[model samples]
Target: MKTPEAGDAIAAAPRRGPLHGLVVLDITRVVAGPYCSMILADLGARVIKIEHPDDPDYVRGFPPFVGEGDDRFSAFFAQYNRHKEGITLNLKHEAGRELLKQLVARADVLVENFRPGTMERFGVGYDTLRAVNPKLVYAAISGFGQTGPNALRPGFDNSGQATGGLWSMNGYPDRTPVRVGTIIGDVSATLFAAIGVLAAVREAERTGQGQMVDVSQQDAVLALTENAVVKYTVDGEIAGPLGNDHPFVRPYGQFPCRDGHVFFGGYNDKLWALSCRKFGTPDLVSDPEIDTMAKRFDPEVYARRVKPVVENWFRERSKAELEAMAGDDIPLCAVKNIREVVEDPHIAAREMIVDVDYPQGRIGMFGTPIKLSRTQAQASGRAPNVGQHNAEVYADLLGIDAESLQRLKSSGVV
Candidate 1:
């Protein structure tokens, strides 16, 4: 498949997504904001990224460049900001602010991730923008939200995980709290922002009035705590980590095998019996002290009677052997490393890993997970160079001529 450079004429391509013809002013940077914008872009929104001419997105400086010298580009930036157009605008300048207001006037949505008061100080808050375009859906993603005492404090993905109780419930009980391997906080916040913006956009279409959609990273992460919040409130139990095991379910965690690891879990009696029978330990199923779910909760009985039987069976078998023996109804899976995941046939068949060609080489990144029946998500394009669509957006959308654009560039207003 051919991947076009974002510098190519984006307007010439036919839009194939549900968000076709919608315009988005993408003023956010880094993880949460860019992630939301990327989803919009994939859905066929014409996202125009705003950046300072002198200092573009900080991720542009991150390592793992695809080329050398003038052609060098950050792969990190490409991972999140793909499928969006770019334009420079130093908001500190009056001309820049005026240009942004002009864009806002024509935009269907405006997304930002600045601290609570940042947009208000810049004179482009929801009220100011709504005054210009009443039907514009304004989405704001912040660390703690637009209100609350901690709204003014600077925050990042780490802060979201720490404050939301994710870190506390991640690791083993005896060890210190450990952050998750991936940035779940930022990713969850991004998804929540996208959902909020989409909901607001749908409502605006019906009511003819757009509203503000505020998403908090901390709140988003906290919503993913499963039963932790309820466990404390309802049962007076502060949930703690239990390693990879299910908190209340016995025999529901990773067990060591001969060559690799396998995770098989089922809380019900049927699954428990099947697991015991599959492991060639049918005798253990009828053992009085370890038969029922209630009896399996005792660590002493589990270690002495149950653990040894399960371990002995798994220790003699390989992951592949165990998988072959267990049927589909049995919840069994081999723990795959990154390389194995990249090579998995299921992932390839699902198109999870996709490639985008650069001037230097082809780079692989995870594709959009959302699949629509009629409208498909696309990632087969290069990330834009800094301000790559300046002339096209300014001259075409804003009706500024080449001479005026050059002047704007020279005066550091673009």
Candidate 2:
């Protein structure tokens, strides 16, 4: 089987967006790190995805593949890797390490997700690379960060959620704590890492000095618990799952409809009054037991007075009917399933669901959420095959000619 050339199946589109001209060396694999780099790529950064020649990224073999034979590739991998260039370099090899250093000298940022000391062992850690290019912003995404007792411990999304106290607070109070629907730990860390990288890059540009941005999955997930930590510390109250209910707000939860469920938020007094009128229960507004926000916030009062009336109103209507009634008056929305979300008029209008063309076929993925008026963030092009840009990137970045690149490939260096 003949291998595809650089940009053979997926041609490189002209760079646009806010991050145009930024050079990113993405030496990460799998979800977290690749996702962060993908965000940068979507924002118009020139991201070069580097991988080991022999091993490649594990996600390349993941399921839900597209195409067949040599043209086959993982849809899951493409979801996070699109709009970036790909190259393979055996970083374990001394020559490959030297070549990476040369590339680093020209890069503005480098992102990696290996364990704490992996880069140091390879002699290309932040401290080493920062010296190679003093203005380079090195961002490291790890399970437990680069410091503390758990630094060396292997961490994953589940472990991060478990140790960070997010897992214990999810699900129903009577049931076993469930992990969040998605890999929130990894994803939150990715967002934080990207922010840190951009912030550090800005600083580097101004001060002509670079620094390391350390982002930990556990730390990021813990930070996103939304007052769970403070509620325990300040009020001496350990919060547990309340199903779909808000902790402090009455009538702020999912209510049953004829067809399905709808989330209704009438927590404030004004909204409560508005909701009461909208639900054809205006008399409930002046009821002494649950008249004001404070009274409705009382668990006993809400359970006895508020829940029954609001739930009854919702149960009498279908999701569509309830939505139509709510309109712009009440803060409510029908709970949408995945199919509904994909087909939703709002989602379509916002361009949240986008289709990217590939050699195999056109696959739909989520578009960028960040919308800049001038330099719009967008996802373009398809992901590259392993080492697809070896010759191009090597020759372009390091001045390595065709002869030298072939020699390096022959020596198992790139």
Candidate 3:
């Protein structure tokens, strides 16, 4: 692909701040890729999420569809696709494939999670796209990688956890391997995708050439559990799961209090002494055997010595009192369910949940975590209806007449 000439690099459409004039075309559905696009969208990029016309986003038909049959909207879709425009493209058709090629010429970033060979099979691979646009960043999220023995394998989040090391590190030693409560591995891949996209974008800005951002679910999972990986490699000892307890650290997990449980990690002497003082059991300070890491690992001695004292103290104190007493000397947090967390003062103050207007009055938007002060990121748009922008985007961008647009719609092409 030839480099863009100064004349070919026309003045870009301005946006509010950073990511101004950026264009993103997202072809992936469900969690990971959508999460990456959502972050980019929140950062002021114009993200166009392409869905198939005949069989829309699988999320449209995913169970928990609200209101009516095939409503074309779902909670899962709404959460992942906030702050983006959506249009349907029947990629199975030649005309539709050509349209994608055209869009690639103008787009800045293209994201997809189709099985390994699907994009190349569609004639819209990077080598093909770069001919039209040299600075087009193509991102792929796959199970293993774009090329590998397991590259084409389906990257189900739970299955990836099992294949990755997370499952082994999740449960108690003797129990069945447990998967995490939510889509953790998927989020992990999304994080990797986000980092890759931004880095590629930065490189393209410097060199005026785009590159491939390949993210593997397997790689992402292993990347996340770094400590466990290092432990295994260093000692040749498989890191075993210890449930709510830390394997190497003492009293570094959840403990039951009067109202509920509280998680605390006493990582050092100062914190450990503070915990002991708070519980009015300062005797823990003098025991040189209990004070050090090696002594704490003596399971029988440590368990019998610490458990009775810690449990009795926790059993007498309420969660609030324990939280107040523990202070910042140790990391302590009361276990909170979703309902409690939604109502939490810090969460509310941080605007983690905002009232977003929907057809059914106002629904909460549990928004993205990052808060940009100078240029605030928001879901300026909502999750779109299928082909909602058919007239605006197709007719305007594709330069198709209204009659032709309607004709294509009638022919199920839009």
Could you estimate the TM-score for every candidate? 0.93, 0.95, 0.92
> How well does model 2 score by local distance difference test?
0.87
Model 2 / residue 108 / CA error / Å: 0.4
Q: Write the per-residue lDDT of candidate 3 for residues 1-414, one digit (tens) a residue.
A: 122332233233234546767778899988879989988987888788888887877775654444555443576677778767778887777777777876677688999988888888888777887787788889998888888788888887886677778888898888987888888878889999999999999999899999999998888888877578778788877876789987677767888998999887774677767778877878887787677655665677658876666778788788889878877666888998999889999898887887656573445658768888798777544777877766666544455667877776676666
Candidate 2 deviant stretches above 4 angstroms: 1-13
- How many clashing residue pairs appear in each of the predictions shown? 1, 0, 0
Worst 10 residues of 3 by lDDT: 1-10
Ranking by TM-score: 2, 1, 3
Identify the superior model by TM-score, candidate 2 or candidate 3: 2
Give, for candidate 1, the lowest lDDT window spanning 10 residues: 1-10
Which pairs in model 1 have colliding backbones?
88-414
List the pairs of residues colliding in candidate 2: none
In model 1, which regions exceed 4 Å deviation? 1-13, 297-304
The best candidate by TM-score is 2
As a TM-score, model 3 comes out at 0.92
After the best TM-score superposition of candidate 1, give how far the Cα of residue 18 lies from its true spot, in angstroms: 1.7
* Best of the two (1, 3) by lDDT: 1
RMSD (Å) of each candidate, 1 decimal: 4.7, 4.3, 3.1
In model 1, state the lDDT of residue 50.
92
